[model samples]
Target: MEGRVLITGVAGFIGFHLARRLLADGWTVLGIDNLNDYYDPGLKKDRLAQLEGHPAFQFQKIDLADRSGMEALFAGPYFDVVIHLAAQAGVRYSLQAPHSYVDSNITGLLHILEGCRAQKTAHLLFASSSSVYGANSHLPYSVHDPVDHPVSLYAATKRAGELMAHSYAHLYGIPCTGLRFFTVYGPWGRPDMAYFSFTRKILAGEAIPVFNHGKMQRDFTYIDDIIEGVTRLIPKIPNAQAAWPQDPAASAAPFRIYNIGNHTPVALTDFIGTLESCLGEKAQIEWLPMQDGDVVATYADVAELQEAVAFAPDTSLQDGLQQFVDWYRRYYG
Candidate 1:
């Protein structure tokens, strides 16, 4: 084994992909997930099926908020890298299920930090979201900008996780990397996402909801690109850059944040058009007002990520969506 890596949400869209990538890279991966029926348990199971074929991959059905379970997992062996990707991930869903976000995103993350503190793990990389930039009116979201304002509970909790990790990194010297992922989409993608749902509707000849009156834009990043960014980041561990009098936000502990996103922002209408092209069918559009807990646009400034990892998510929307459409048709059939 190159290194022992633990990935929470191993059955998740990104986590599953990350697990496969790590296994191929000769790393022993220990994955954990509650396998809750958030989107589709069958999808999670299918993803798990793929990883289970690899000898280097081991999985445990456990919740991150389960303190005893987390402690037990950490008490056994020290993981070289802990990729915390598990969270109740939905901006709109947050309105209805706020507690789940708190339980999984906040309390669950506490357990992860505690485990790392006990083990003093080499590096910790966790998922953050572009939603953290909440109503900032910033053209392209940057890591240097302050994320004090958050619109949704999901975003708030993600930002909270970053703060918690920063504290852990500062106190326990755990090298932490906070990844602010943009609108991620592609194969084995979350069914709840607009892209996936839209594809399904378009296939079924139903109307796809165009939110924000079809004026919204999203920096849709492909799954492979996100995995590439994350894979590159795993090895570039953080080092505390602060002195006592320095700003904690800047020099805070061994903490750093990166915007892993496609620099291109695609309009919702154009995105749907491309998906239609890929599926070779026209979509019935249901233009509606923007729902709460949703942003009008998200563009990522990945200069920092490029500088650190020499990479950024550049997969074009047309290419990414077509790949997704292909996967959706194959997977559903």
Candidate 2:
């Protein structure tokens, strides 16, 4: 509790909430984000405003790819841990702009690894995604499962990050925790996400695109559940364990990966129904074929996450969707 933590991507949905939670728990937090216009900058600023006047919080407008800036940040303070949530995110956007993923997810992650190695940070917790379990036919995607078949550029880059982290962990003995998050949604969520956009379209009497003809399903983990799992794992950094094998997925080094997701995967149509129920308006339907780089479904096997962190996402889809709808009305109305 008496330690300073550095969180990259502080302007992002998950990062903002994580930093806020840490600050409230009496942790000194240094938050850094480029505040890119991937979505509305206004929402990002609003999130930052929530942390204003919180004595334990500090903010810096810095790009993760800026190696010098990253080095300066790590050198300035002997941080107890680094929670990296910054990345050029989005599956569809990656198809259009693949270089952005390379610059941010690949280069940016390398910079972070360098910083952690030099500073000897006790632990480094970074974000991964369920998308990495690409093209897998297996149900309830597990951390132990091979994730080499990444279907999207974004997902491939994220998997690359895990490999990069492993190399650094093996060479320098830096403790690294990689969390593969499921479909995270809640208040202050990203506008590019399906739930947020669907809500807006539905409320405005516009048609919401039901991709794959609404046949898809997702393990929609709530934002609060993600925070709970992450915070709980902060104290459980993987160290040199005799039980670990040399498998690339499971590390002999002080590194680990966990799939943090809601075990329940709701069908796309049902999820929309839940949203409609929450907003008191039926969505105008625009059934469409699946877009490029889109998958049919995603489900997480969270037994490892639950066993290791003593946490699992328990928020029901209705409850989480209702919270999002409520926030949307107040924020956009």
The clash numbers for all candidates, in the given order, read 0, 0
The residue ranges of model 1 lying beyond 4 angstroms of the native Cα positions read 242-249
Clashing pairs in 2: none
Write candidate 1's Cα lDDT for 140-208 as tens digits.
Answer: 888878889999999999999989998888888999999999999999999999899988888898998
Models, CA RMSD each: 1.4, 1.0
lDDT of each: 0.91, 0.92
* TM-score result, candidate 2: 0.98
Candidate 2 C-alpha lDDT tens digits along 145-243: 888899999999999999999889989999999999999999999999999999889978999999999999999999999999999999898987677
Candidate maximizing lDDT: 2
